[model samples]
Target: MGESFPMKSGDDSHSYSKNSLYQKLASDTVKEMIQESVIKYLDTDKVTSSMGSTTIALADFGCSIGPNTFLAVQNLIQPLQTKNLEFQVFFNDHFSNDFNTLLTSLPPERPYHAAAVGGSFYGRLFPRNSLTIAYSSQSLHWLSKPPQGVNNEAGIHGSGAPEPVARAYSAQFEADLGCFLDARAEEIVSGGLMFLVMPATPDGLTQTELSALFDFYGYSLMDLADKGVVEKSRIEEFNLPIHIPRLGEMREVIEKNGCFRIERMELTNPKSKVAGPLDAANVVTHMRSAMEGVFAAHFGASVADQMFDNVVPMTPRIADCFKALHHISNQLFVVLTRK
Candidate 1:
């Protein structure tokens, strides 16, 4: 799962950077979750000498770009700074990530010194017992690749999948998540804390409007394939590397790992409503930004653009994106303590 999906770049039209603006609401939700957890940790628990030396080592895995990452780090640092603590923050992503934008735009002075570490969170990146606090937001749902042997013609649309296909996806998710826990367990100290904010589905709701939206895009690809713009097999091979987990599924993975205790878990959203099509366009751009790189890498940029352009008017069904602050959708937050 070391494959890279760089956010759409360039200053034209809509790119991953622009698409990520919609995630601000989601960012705020996670930032607050981290802040509260930080407060709770400070109240009752204290880190050992190895865990909390003079500097608190923090890492935010899958940190995309500026503004949001900046805000998240700032939120985490403010509470620590008040307690006379310093930080060594590491911003991590895949190797092909836009580290330049994130590194260059960092503030002239801040509470923490920042560095970039490139790798997949599904494997170990840091030394044993190094990270005092670890975080990953909107990143875990991505499987290393589409499930092997599954015929997901409609990509990740749970509604479009047959029983076997869904089972294959679930198996892949379990394997990926297991690897994530094993990696993080080695990186974080015994008493360290971790904050995970991931996309989720409610129990029994296999598909959300987001999944439906992706399903529609898969259908659109078939439409293009019918005209010979792209091969039908291309669509079949191009599944989004995502699997939206349910809250219970999340809990099961954490508990099964045995290295971490679930201190808190919540399923809620920002409840912010997107105004209209422009905001809805953010949804399209967000997905495009995430999937375009893979599409272009596998096919060609021309095909990626052609298919993306065909869906220009693709606003999500609702005002707010399901991944965003939409009231109806479930945004999952899990706070864990390494035991």
Candidate 2:
């Protein structure tokens, strides 16, 4: 397993808490599915009876600093609340994550007792069969670490990466996702429900629009390299620690793990009317919030800041690349039952 890399922290303009509307939109697209799945598949009676406890434990794995996590937790607990059960909600992520921001920004009238668990979700974070529900949104795509010894000189993601690099990413995701499933299997009670939402494709292939975005990002970084602002070797050495899994790949992993039975799964567009278009500015902000940590780690923070700052003025030139992405269905939503 690799180490944990968290999203950008704090409440600043570029912070994940402020710029994670993209993830929030993805979460919203599956809100109804989560609620309905809980109602139909979650055996609350069985969990309470088996544990002999009314306090239902729920966990949000990879929950970054957020208002989004708060919304997701509420949705998952809403159905259980009708049963008059007490709730313990665990907000989990990397130890470096901004738990202070998450804890302080929590809804004042929230119904459950909340605690922060610091660590990677690719491993167990709770005692065996202690959770009644497990949820992760826009998070699982991130690998425990970038694939070792893969030279992805083309782009940061698998979109335009070389064959070896792409395979490495896919293989790492398969293993990391396996670890995640195995851990969640031990954590969730029998008949418990797990909901996941993340950026994924039909065949684990990179979408054309996403490829274009990656290319644009590559262009921006190479331009910096040309200006001697950052090393070309560093650019080539850097690959984003994320993998968008194919539906078939996900199915294979779930079945192979033999711990959770797939209840429902679907691919959908995360586009939203309220969220507006996938314009250049929106893309830049979302990428910065999500990737700044990775970038800052590879390059210095000052260099990362300079690179993103330079991209802002060039948005007019790159606006075309980010357009038309709204028509693509790139979000994967899944519901699982702990067997």
Candidate 3:
């Protein structure tokens, strides 16, 4: 599980400065898929009668400032014009998240009222069984804790070796998986929908793979830290707690809750034909807000910029990263319906 970082509410200057580059590169496809998945679970009869009066509260878990969120709302509302369900959308992240920018980006005329909810999803954020739908993309891999018995110096444990570290991560994964489901069970209403998209290995994530990715990210960040571009102390304070749950692992979590039923499970390898590596990096940057702490802790403050710079000038390298990702089937898309 990934550790939580303190988020900034409203328009904090530091928040904007830190996340600007990332927000620029949000992915339209990710937004579209989320919208589509949620729509699939709408109670049509209930929605039609509401006429924008019935409260249909939707949440974008770990939502950040970017076009992808707007696109998600666009896709959600377009299908609801006829239904006219009163929309109350909440953009949720840690307190350190930039809520102001997200609000500013939204149109004032939108029927929905948007608010930012701070804190980790491993805890409750809503009234029991109150939310109508919840959506999270590329975010679930972030766990709330490092594997047990491993200190922060180990760089998120299990990212270094295959023996005890892997076991530690797996144990932590099982515990966090339970926490996530329990929290969601309390929050999502009966018949509600939840959509999650994240990076995962075929047999679930192994410590070795996690270690490699963490090493890459940590090395990149340490490089910037060496340049005094970002504070090394801050890096130490932050924790990159991601646990890439396999399909079975996720199923185990959901089933244990016995509140949500799997509606769809897909493994997507989205390929884009952009000009070159820079364009590819742009896609990554857009996705960065969701990954801020994970990369930042390792690469320091300049990590995001460095990643963009590295990918921009090197097409082959960018292609290679993409290819490597695909080679391992690194992404997963899942949709669940409330029982």
Candidate with best TM-score:
2
Q: Candidate 2: lDDT of 49?
A: 94
- Estimate TM-scores for all models: 0.91, 0.94, 0.72
lDDT of 2 by residue, 198-274 (tens): 87777745664455666666777888999998889889888777787788888888888899889998888877544
Better-scoring candidate (TM-score), 1 or 2: 2
Name the lDDT of candidate 1: 0.75
Candidate 3 vs. truth: CA RMSD? 5.4
Worst 10 residues of 3 by lDDT: 269-278
TM-score of 3: 0.72
Please give the TM-score that candidate 2 achieves against the real structure: 0.94
Q: lDDT of each prediction vs. the true structure?
A: 0.75, 0.83, 0.60
Better of 1 and 3 by lDDT: 1
How close to the true structure is residue 294 of candidate 2, measured as C-alpha lDDT? 75
- 29-86: candidate 3 lDDT, tens digit per residue: 3556666665677775654344333777788777756435655666566666666457
